[model samples]
Target: MNAINITSTEILSDSWYTLKKISFEITANDGTKSTQEREAYDRGNGATILLYNRSNKTVVLTRQFRMPTFINGNETGYLIESCAGLLDKDNAEDCIKKETEEETGFRIDKVQKVFEAYMSPGSVTEIVYFFTAEYTNEMKVHEGGGLIEENEHIEVLELPFGKAIDMITTGEIKDGKTIMLLQHALINKLMG
Candidate 1:
């Protein structure tokens, strides 16, 4: 039996992504029902990738300004994160590959999918596909800083895997997806 039945959906905002207020009725296991309304932000699905070099024990990351984090407490508003992009009309693999080249300048032909996750399940309707790929200096074709028309000014950083891991404890790397990928690398020994 379905526990939730959506009654009506109201569009709150569509200026950027879509923000909707959804009203629903949920039946509890104990034979109780309650009406509720929740706001969900739908920005479509995305894919993120960690580019690592096992020989050098290094990982590639990008730093960019995030307006949301700025207002929420990030003094600089810049976040270091894995290369990621919205799926748009492409599949997860294709999107991540394109994002990797655009954000990190590394044109990787092969990628290993790590997992899929909902970064925020409470309100956001986005599931991020996580991937990892081995990279080398020869793979870099250009200086990647994201799309100019899109107004993305990304700074690329290549750091030692160990140093990147330590950044997690020092609060230097705070993005959830980046942290998860780093931890995944550490746990799976992707560096060594």
Candidate 2:
């Protein structure tokens, strides 16, 4: 296999997040080779899950404040998104399960892997694991709104699947992962 040789990786920032500048020699598709340098943001990998109930015709979601959106264009900084979090030290499934409960207050037992994607490939190195799970009223055990210590003040939202899907067109939901999961559900006929 052809390989891209990494010559050097220099740390540019080491605060809340990490940024590294690297020089690498890459081979083009036409068999040409050249050296390039670029900075990459390493926030680590994460997982996202969409909880849906076929019988109830509804899905679970979360609303939270994202500073990046506010700075970019949103005035309130609030976003409607799927339950997600960084993988930390656990595997994708485990991380998604823990995040689902912590942020939405629902403990899920079984989850099926839907897909995996790289949300941002230009500068950030984050590979996200996408999943969907079936849930019922019996699965909810706690009042979920995220952890105070983690500074997560999330709001749990259980909306009709159809309505939530329509939200995408109306611009109510803006998160990428949420959009993908919603479309997946529609295309896969996850709802009854």
Candidate 3:
């Protein structure tokens, strides 16, 4: 294993989240040392969940406009994604539950944490916790469109499980977290 030492960190932006340029030195196993610098966006960690209904073969999702996606060649800028939110002062499970109700109108009491991952390790310092939950129409507490105070205008979508799966291949669903959760559902036969 290579030994790493963080030499310096400079704050680049702190308007919304934090963006820092970090400088470090690595001493390799072969006795070679090198210095490197990289910028990392720290939006903190987050949690995402897929709400599936086995009887109805449906899943709850959200559609929202993402500026990064729009500037990166996504013409429409609207992305279909699993319900997710940053774990501000809450734990992963609590964050997901709050996010699920706020973003998708589903008040899920039980969620099985499937996994956790660094969605973009190269430039972002966010490890997202992934979860899955079963939902029914009775769980819908309100018409979810995200929190207005947060400037989030999410569109709730209840799509057929099979259609959601097909959207991945058709490029209709491109959100990384959403794809991962949907694939998890498919692989685990969650709809059955």
Candidate 4:
């Protein structure tokens, strides 16, 4: 991997936060030098949190329309996922906290950092910070459905932890980050 040298990077499009691009490269590993163009979308890193209710054995999630998914094949594009948002300026932790409240109506005191992963390494340059937190009825401070002005018409969902896990295999939940967080909770016996 270190043997590869990126000769140049060209931006093909930057209409969205995701920018498309191409690059030329040379590799010493295979003693090959070639001009290859590829896309690299960098929208900055993001954070996702799964709020679990130990007593109720439920997990809070959100549903929102994703244009990319709509065009790709999902007619509805209403993805069921954990509370998430881009870390525009704040750090990952702070970003998740704000997002959790805005997207799920739950104010989390402490979020456990579980892991980090790249959504799509082939093209997207976004890494997602995964988190877990416990939710109580007392945490409800507002009715969250995302920012309307931001065009985020989100639907908050609180389903049994087991049911949420089942959604993964049943083809209901397709978001990668959401899947990982749910699996983490089940595998770690986070539910009381």
Candidate 5:
């Protein structure tokens, strides 16, 4: 088995939302000698989506414009994602709870963790932990409040589970974290 060890790490930039750094390393696979550096966005406090299942076989999602992708020619950049967020010293359950209320205004009674992944293992070290919450029509969700000042304009949408999967396969839902959740649900037969 090949193993890599970290010799040292240096922070090139730091901010409330992002951190850029470089690292000195050694690869034992074939005595590969090299130095690697990465620019990482702290993205402090990850993100989440509320999958509220309404009657008629539909689940609620959010449509929001992502600036990062917008510049890349993704005109809308509107994403269909599940409820998720960063650990940030807070356990997965707690963080999800907070994001659920903030993003969708739905109070979750129960949560089941689906999966977790590093958003971008190549350059950034952002791990998005995802889960599914069982919500009923009785739940009261207020007018969603997102980071408007941050230029985030979002609209809540309810889509059929099958349609959501189709969106993922068709590349309509492009966010890595959201894809992870949808794939897990599909593979595990949990999207009821």
Candidate 6:
């Protein structure tokens, strides 16, 4: 089925990020009918995940504040997550690798591709590219986090496989891509 063509669009908000109102229509593959015009967004590529294997049977996650969740009665809204960032560059793998080193202080190799999917397809167009990399504790050369001037306060968490599951069930691990990476590794027996 061919995707609908954009008929018209409006700029809702444009800053560091952007929001748009778009109108489009879909032509059914079966030629049964043509759907009416619909409105959606065109949020560019904006999210990714970096999975790290410690070689001793655990993964490294990070805790950080999310303003949206915080305002939704989440209190501190600190979430446990993998080394992740937005996909603004031309290369997804390169971007995730740089984010892993910058956010977790781990220099890794043998980056393996996993799944690439949307983070929030219903409202937000956040497509996430997931990955896995084998690493050791020795790879750490510097503390990982966003620059302080950006108001980022991250806490690194090195947790066992089982503990990561518990965190997921308890809502401590709220990021979708992070959970997906953990589950993917756990299911495939890739982490050890």
lDDT of 6 by residue, 58-134 (tens): 78888888777888888887777788777675578887777777777777765888878877677777777788887
TM-score of each: 0.98, 0.95, 0.98, 0.94, 0.80, 0.86
| lDDT tens readout by residue for model 1, 46-115 | 9999999999999999999999999999999999999999999999999999999988888999999999
Each candidate structure's count of clashing pairs: 0, 0, 0, 0, 6, 0
C-alpha lDDT score of every prediction, in listed order: 0.97, 0.95, 0.96, 0.88, 0.66, 0.74
Instruction: Between candidates 1 and 4, name the one with more favorable lDDT.
Output: 1
At residue 107, candidate 1 shows an lDDT of: 94
**lDDT string, candidate 5, 1-192, tens digits:** 545555566666665565666565656567776666556656754645446463455666777766778889888766666655466778778887876766676777687765666667777777666677667766656766555664546676667878888997788888776666666666766655
RMSD of 4: 1.4
Candidate 2's error at 6, in angstroms?
1.3
lDDT of 2 by residue, 158-179 (tens): 9999999999999899999999
Model 2 Cα shift for residue 89 (angstroms): 0.7
| Stretch of 10 with least lDDT, candidate 6 | 32-41
What range of 10 consecutive residues in model 5 has the weakest lDDT sum?
Answer: 47-56
For 14-131, candidate 4 gives per-residue lDDT tens digits of 6777576656675656676666778888889999999999999999999999989999999897899889999999999999999999888888889899999998999889999999
Clashes of 5: 6
TM-score of 5: 0.80
Judged by whole-model lDDT over C-alpha atoms, candidate 6 comes out at 0.74
TM-score of 3: 0.98
Candidate 6 at 56: error in angstroms? 1.7
